[model samples]
Target: MKPKPPTHITVFAKADGAAPTYWECPSCGFLSGDARFLDTEHPCPECGAVGVERRRFPSDRVRRLDERIRSYQKQGDGEIVVILVMTLLETILEDILDRMMDAHGGDLPLRRMIMDSQRSIGVRIGKLFPALAGEEFEEAAAELGYRDFPKHWRTMREARNAFIHDSPFGGPRERLDARMGEDAMVLLDQAYRLFVLLNNRFVADGHTRS
Candidate 1:
């Protein structure tokens, strides 16, 4: 009826290196270099008032973006490891200080401990998402509505610390399911979310692909 949007469309082009040339769109039948629009769906530049799919670049920009996304994916995995380790360590230290501060009843020491932990987390977050560092942690916390995550963080730290210090947490899960199983999962999950967040930021900034 409406031109039945061709069953399929494909593009061919020549490039160096002696390989067959073809650019293709996986969506509705659209040619690679045809009619100026199959990269993303957008308002048609030519037909005026009608919408069309945009064309993708076999251009340097597209290739570069593809490469960058791969690189970020690998880097994201590495950072996830570092974040879990650091957060766990910081949590243990925070727990110890929290107890001390509660016993002492002086805001100075507790404030200092909090500031230190916040700074450490901020520095690590920047390593993962550099753009986030320019903003204050308070603001970020407010944005996330995570004003009281210290307790959770501390628990993670203590769990990790138990594993490190040859404590009961190290026992085989068949013996006790309480500590090791859940804590390890939580840390892993947190690390993964951090990875996703960073990867998304890189894509959004135009430095990488989705």
Candidate 2:
């Protein structure tokens, strides 16, 4: 019998204290933080695509923001961390959706019009992303080993909303703590990898356009 695949993958950090290091399979758009997966003979878990070359995500802005968020977290500024991370996550999601729209033949002006109309993250993830990617965002994320991402993201968003807005019902039911802030950080790291995989799948290879 073939040896069992590794259950846990390692995410390596950069020497410059930049973004965490990960690998991308060009052939199948699979993303992995595990260094073992970078071997030339290793096959992509999702598509059986083989390659040794690993690609890095071009995310200078995201990385800079992530560093700042980390600093806030270290200082025990939970509220700031949560707020900033939520904003960052939304921006990243918007970028991915925009790229997906572009791959599906949307021009610059058309893409702007479309995005302007769907400012709600729920609608974007549930309806727009699926319409462009040919799969539900949650399903795609789960397939790529981020099964809890959608739920966690929604929870954080709800918390952020509650904290930001004073409702007559309760005037903000939940308070964001350091734990939640740490969770937000975890999600931030995962988002970069997931979005990169998504871009490679739909945008980089010209799959949707073709």
Candidate 3:
């Protein structure tokens, strides 16, 4: 069966200050910050579609938080680094899901209500994300060269929970050390690229949003 087209598309406009500019391909949903993409005629790296219209990606808040996390990591604040990196990763996941919803013609209130009903990260990733993206999250991650991302993310989450909750029966299983913090930083870097790939595969197709 044929799919419907996207009802609306997101476009990028010029912004002030040090914030980066982003562009999204109208044809394939490939997004990039390169100035060359803003030109009238450019081939999409993913789909090879010509003269694709590129829209701006609205990610100012996410960018700011990412910068803050990087700054803290440099100071040897392992605890903060681990916690913040997890938060950032989750935030990116949320953003991607939101875009996916938007691609499906889901309104803001509906998206909020649906998301609010499923607050657990495990449910969101294991069930909700796959249902929306039309494939399992782990499969997508693996295809995108992030085969270990899910496991590593889960491990970090366990460490963060252990540190925060300090289980009554077992006590804290382990301390979030510098090594974990370093791992978090690496994941943080990878998350953006992976999310973008996911977006292109699932959300960037113009049919999804329609």
Candidate 4:
């Protein structure tokens, strides 16, 4: 099953020791991650509304799932690690897309509708992201110093799919090796940083200013 509109995430904090906190406007559902104005004393940048709630971006549920994945990694179960990390990555992508839509003033229903209509990750990254951010996902990632992230993510997804699905033309992949598992771990770490950058740029940019 695919997700939106929903999603492990469990991102760590920067060297400064503050886990990035996403503050959402209860009034309009606008989200922001600007360190300068994380405190809710400022008005909602989108609607000038007060009382923006502080929400940990990964949320508690995601953190719990992350713990399970880490345990699996510790056990050296490469196949399971690959599958779970792939699922987690997709979930994170969907959420970031939703967050970007929210930043652009899309309400819950509207965001849901958009995500529901466009379920393909390739399409979401190739088309939807540009429509919202005025730049290609690869281009954006390049600017953010993860120039190869999208390509690497796509390659990993293909590996995961080959292992999971049976192909009429070619047999399904039988196993995911330790190398793939390690790659997933690397991507997982990179994902947190990439996600934070995207959130800071798209969800918490000028839209949340008082």
Candidate 5:
């Protein structure tokens, strides 16, 4: 069957030279990273303004971000599944960290949680291969340039910030749902790709013939 046309969410992009930051909410004065949830009556959380309209436009660096956003609006089962799977993984990881912190009588900050995962995996690898040691892989990733890891992290964080701050995007629940779902999928997919890139590097480093 022919696919349905994608609904274009109104994305407001910053100037071209700047990073794709801050989506303006259409409903209210709220400006945030994600505008998927704002509608007219809801008003802007930031300024209590009403009857605003949201329009989103991403930069070239964030062009791919719109692909899945459009896909979700088109209601593609495959894209939905991909997004759900990645969200599940994130939830599981968070649970594991929570349990570990409970056992240790401490909490893991967001940055620490990400760093610990890499370090834990690296430790296991080091034990099996005496040549590689602590922090070496991280250093290599920093030096040789691992793609998407940090970029996706930033993107996801930005989206979350936009959602929380009640950017002007606040609006009717139905419209917001469509926007939120799209933004969530895009942000998660970006993270998933980064994780995959890191995993691929891990596999390649460990699979040496020597």
Candidate 6:
């Protein structure tokens, strides 16, 4: 039987202002922001190809959106920070998953159709990732040493939804506080690392090794 997904809660540490930096393998397009990844002249873990030049992951467009989020955060607009943070996280998730699918030989139109049909974040985590990755999202996260990430992300998503959409039962969340904004920042920092690990493992290594 498959192991159950983790149900434990997560706590966040204070986040710094700087964003994480990641390097990509030009040969296979694997991305990793972990310092350990860039520390030496290791062969590209994906295609086993040595590289001449590498591009930065989380491209310029993404960096600009991250800047906007930081600006909102600095201005103490917690509500907007929470919302835009979710947007940025979702974008990263979509980008990595698309790359994973591409590595698995999915064509563009098919990938777009799949993404369109399963637009909900819940489905993406619970169903879509597993379908491609051959394991639960929670399982993958735990193995990658971020056991609490999925739980914390789910909580933040709940908070974001409460604030963005009216609930027939509870109306809507009045506002997202600075504490929640702080939590969002913590998750934002973790996202780059977690998704990079995932991309490196599943999108690149998983595909190439198999």
Score each candidate by Cα lDDT: 0.35, 0.74, 0.74, 0.72, 0.38, 0.78
Alpha-carbon RMSD, each predicted model: 18.5, 6.4, 5.8, 6.9, 22.3, 5.5
Q: Give TM per candidate.
A: 0.27, 0.73, 0.79, 0.77, 0.26, 0.84
lDDT per residue as tens, model 3, 1-210: 222333333333344322345777776566765677788576665556666567776477877887787777778888988998898788878888877887787899999998899888998998888778777899889976799989999989989988888698879855678888899988876676677667766776633335
Model 1: weakest 10-residue lDDT segment is: 201-210
lDDT digits (tens) for residues 83-190 of candidate 1: 344444344334333332332343676557654666654354333223332343333333334443434554555544454456554552123133433443344334
Clashing pairs in 6: none
Output the better candidate (1/6) by TM-score: 6
Error of 4 at 151 (Å): 1.1
For candidate 6, the per-residue lDDT at 6 reads 26
User: lDDT of candidate 5?
Assistant: 0.38
Q: Clashing pairs in model 1?
A: 37-53, 37-54, 37-55, 38-53, 38-54, 38-55, 39-54, 39-55
Model 2 lDDT per residue over 9-106, tens place: 43444444346666766654445666666786776554556655766544667778878988998899999999999999899899888876765667
* Model 6 lDDT tens row, 21-85: 67777666666544444544666555656634667777888989998899988898889888998
What is candidate 1's CA lDDT for residue 43? Answer: 31
Off by over 4 Å in 2: 1-17, 21-58, 207-209
Candidate achieving the largest lDDT: 6
